[model samples]
Target: MPGRTGARHAVVRPPAAGRTAAPVAAGLVLVLLVLVVVRLPWVGDLGMHAATVQRLRHSPLDPGNPLVDADTPSPYYSPWMLLLGTVARVTDLPVFAVLRLAAAAGLALLVTGVWRYVKTLSAHRAAPALALLSLLLLWGTTPFLWSGFPGLHSLALTVSYPSTFTLGLAFHFWAWLTRAVRGAAGWGVWLGLGALWAVILLCHQFSGVVATAGAVATVLAARPRRTAWLRPVAGLSAGAVVLWAWPYYDFFALFGAGDGLEPVHRVLYGHPVARFGLVLLGVAALVPRWRRDRRDPLVVFFALGVLVVGAGWLSGHYSWGRALPAAVVPAQLAVALEAVGAGRRRLRAGWAALLTGALLLGGWAQAGTLGYVVPRGALPQALEDRYRPPWTGYHWITPWVRYGDVVLAEGRPARQIPAYGPYTVAPGYPDFFLPDEERRTKATGTYFAERTPESVRRGIEREYGVRWVVDRTGALDGTGLRAVARGPDGQVLYAVP
Candidate 1:
């Protein structure tokens, strides 16, 4: 029953005259909830993840592989999909609605955690509230928004990404770890830490890397004597081995053998110098506090965030770069909020104005995102119809697709049909773990575009075991496929027979 010892001295106390924290926190939650309501069934990864949940609901015992067109065994350790799928089954709710609800829940948790974590960093009432506002709205202005940057994809992908779910959970774990390391926690805290990491690892392997590393850094900072290291290191390693080892071992060889990176269009907003300048500004801002708060556990946490991004850029891994926001943003907010809470009257005012402006900009950016029909761009007429009520693009073709049937479809159709239906989509989204994913994806373009000869068609069908084709735009010229279904949007589903 050692309550948070030194809790009062943990951070600078808030000024006596500041506004109440509850209303601001509730407002932030409302904003996120509104977003979830407006943007239902988000396209891209969200849609795909929803598709996976839907599949799991029907075949809870054997969900098979939701990623591909065939029942190729899934190598992913996706506890998130299983959790949502189980909920969908029990509640009898539509998969898309489940996805939206999950998003709202995640955002709520994230805001609440932010509010709590900020209190540990600084006691300024506005610091926690302002930090929440800044992060949710001003995210687009960060370097992470750069086109091709990992941050853009990570945040934009929303609920579909297992990493996205980890955002709030990780922070709460962080708060608990800080308390536990300080000897304020009991045996239950230790158990909770281990259990949390296990869930994180099972949810996403990449998140495990960041979370485990962060946890280790936290333990090192706390420097707790007598078996302190044992619990964190042992717990994290065990979870990694149990959840991560199997999928990685199964897929690592294939991942390494896979082809090189394909080019993607970059979306650069500010000049390159602007990004660097922001980093410089952050470092400069931290310099004053370094002498005073250098040994602070949260300081180490912030350094780890910078290290993750720097290493990501040097190692040529986009995942690390994209994930920087999730791992680092909280730390960034903490740094700023602490500065605001601990600074003088004039200094605090300047910081507050900057944060407020950032929040406004962030809100504008979010508006733009919500206005878009799809995450990447405007959805095609075919895809637009797919999201509508009663029946959709996937509905038209799914009935004809049998289990284990490999169907050839273009990228849009490929991503959608297999997600909501029982069939596997041919040449679907590129999975780094799937060895031939890149090769198959490239060939898909050629197969759909060219006047493929019967010889080529037969060879492809023979090689990939393709039996049906969803021709969205009359892309099947030389491939002799018989039309079995015509879609509302001029889409044709062809059977090889």
Candidate 2:
């Protein structure tokens, strides 16, 4: 699709009035840039997602309950996984490899989306470049500078998350909506928006809500004449809700109604100073221009998104709150860039060079730190490689563990052990939000905290159908379980005798 400015059906609007035209080359470079930045495949969500995607490849229509042994139905909707898995199968690459490629594609889309969003919002020449640079740099500023380590949260969204990619798709949806408001969009655009709506929901529920809310807020806050587009907006949203009714019902029934789970007080993610700084600058720039661009849909969208996200955080909705940074950073950057670009004549070249230098240096440092922490393999190579050590010997466990054969494990290993292999943890709830109180209580009381080895074994067998115990600390020696395999580090797989 050709770039169109001013919501007219014009197809020849370049990014700026007089920029060189190498869009294809630029796209290739952006993809290469993203591929280089995202070197590793595995991350926090990849294990479960990859495992699920791999399964869905075999049975694309029905990825029957991933966490249980029986054919228990699940409410999860994973169009992202289905698509990624299809790509992997077609390309004959490992699921992890395909995920890496997907990450690169997502990065490219985000870059393109950011540029387009800025172009649609402002006529400033430097806005697109500045926005793109701001987004790509210093995502680890808060974590790295404050805590001396790169944060996993930013990396997860940028490299592995389905919702992260949706940021781009969401922006594209916004652009089409902008066109729709001007009566320039066709039925095809409306159909496309509907498809994007479904894609966002199927990818990540939290981000999906965020996108919907942003669009709704923008539309509702639109000037009177633009409000006509609200019909399509409302129709698209209601259609999405109706189509995904079952999944939504299941999600609320099991996951959203967090009745028994302990109140999670900690924020899973944080705003990196570099990114937040850009948002602050955007807000500052937006203020002076408020009189002129007050009615811009993108302007209203950002304004409302900032307010809503702030309210969510203050209200202790941390899951959604934590998502705000990834959800709004790109748009915020565009706003700031446009603000700055509008006054380019007053902007100093020295300051621009300085800002660019700082962002590039910050990106380099974060990438170096990321490489150190990101482990190798779907499971860590140390754990996967055989004959390295008894601790290293556990890599063999995932394949041997039969489907629904309940196992006992914890931490990262626990999340993957069941998905990569057929085994399910006693309390192997795939989604932490969808807690099975009974199963969790049983595991906590009898299996994880048993006073004696015999009690632990008995509790496992009775409550969880657990036949294997993946002990990392060599603590299950006297539990009447044989050490089926042991790694060099002494992590052992104990079979119930």
Backbone clashes for every candidate come to 7, 11
TM-score against truth, every candidate:
0.78, 0.76
For model 1 the local lDDT of residue 152 reads 24
Determine which window of 10 residues in candidate 2 has minimal summed lDDT.
Answer: 385-394
Global Cα lDDT for candidate 1: 0.56
Query: What are the per-residue Cα lDDT tens digits for candidate 1 across 1-497?
Result: 12233344333444554455424653854554455444543445544665678667877667656756444445343666677888999999877777766766665566676677666666655666666654544344432332112232224435335555666666677667766786656556676688787776556555555666667656767777775666666555555455545432243343452233322312221253433223333344455556665655555655776676666556654445434553345444654564455547677667555655544544543443333234434644433432322124476665777645677777677767665554543435555545567667766666776666677767776777678887777767445678888887788888875
Model 1: weakest 10-residue lDDT segment is: 261-270
| lDDT (Cα) of model 2 | 0.53
Candidate 1's C-alpha runs over 4 A off are: 1-29, 60-62, 69-75, 142-157, 184-188, 244-284, 370-405, 425-427, 432-439, 442-446, 462-467, 477-480, 484-491
lDDT of 1 at 311: 69
Q: Candidate 2, residues 1-497: lDDT per residue as tens digits?
A: 33336632222233442233223323443554554455543434545655665666655656555554444444444666677767766777866667677777666566667676666655545556655555555243432221111122254334555655676666666666655654555556666677677677666665666667656644554453554565676558655664556442244454453322224413433544653443354454455446655654545656666665666567665544534543355344544344344333335343344455545554443443333233434434432331111111134785556645667776556666644545455333434433463565456445545365675557556666778777775556666678877655567877876
